[model samples]
Target: MTQQNPGSAPDEESPAGDPWHAFGYLVAGVAMYGFLGWLADRWLGTSFLVVLGILLGAGLGLYMTFARFNRPPDPQSKQEKN
Candidate 1:
């Protein structure tokens, strides 16, 4: 008697749902790390920390984005639905 939408499940949240979320994560990480690196550079009189920070931030941001968004749907949810 219940009608469910085809191809899209109620509990399923596709990663493509909100791209800005990922973008924000990446940008925030880069900015924070870059700022820290700049501070270290100023304190140590080194110019490479900024670049290192940026790279580290980008890597971490990407990792977090994937980790947070790329989760497999819960098997229990599907079982319960059926």
Candidate 2:
């Protein structure tokens, strides 16, 4: 019989294992697009273009959310323990 340490390292890559990576990407994309929207409002002197930019940013965020959830599991999951 053998005992496995409960504190043994996880089976996933730590940095890449974090689910927040997708969230960070989503926030960055949204912020960039929002800034574009503000710039458009400033240059065009109208809110229409700004609104459009925001909508486009929202679409990008939605797509990224879907992509993150669809990604395959970490490769370490396939490793065999002796």
Local distance difference test values of all predictions, in order = 0.86, 0.70
Q: Which stretches of model 2 miss by more than 4 angstroms?
A: 1-17, 72-82
Candidate 2: tens digits of C-alpha lDDT, residues 1-82: 6664566664534343346766776777778898898898899798777677767877898788778777786565545343
Candidate 1's displacement at residue 17, Å, is 4.8
lDDT of 2 at 17: 35
Which residue pairs show backbone clashes in model 1?
none
How many steric clashes between backbone atoms does each model show? 0, 0
Model 1 root mean square deviation, Cα atoms: 4.1
Candidate 2 C-alpha error for residue 73, in Å: 6.0
Residue 64, candidate 1: alpha-carbon lDDT: 84
Q: TM-scores of the models, in the given order?
A: 0.77, 0.55
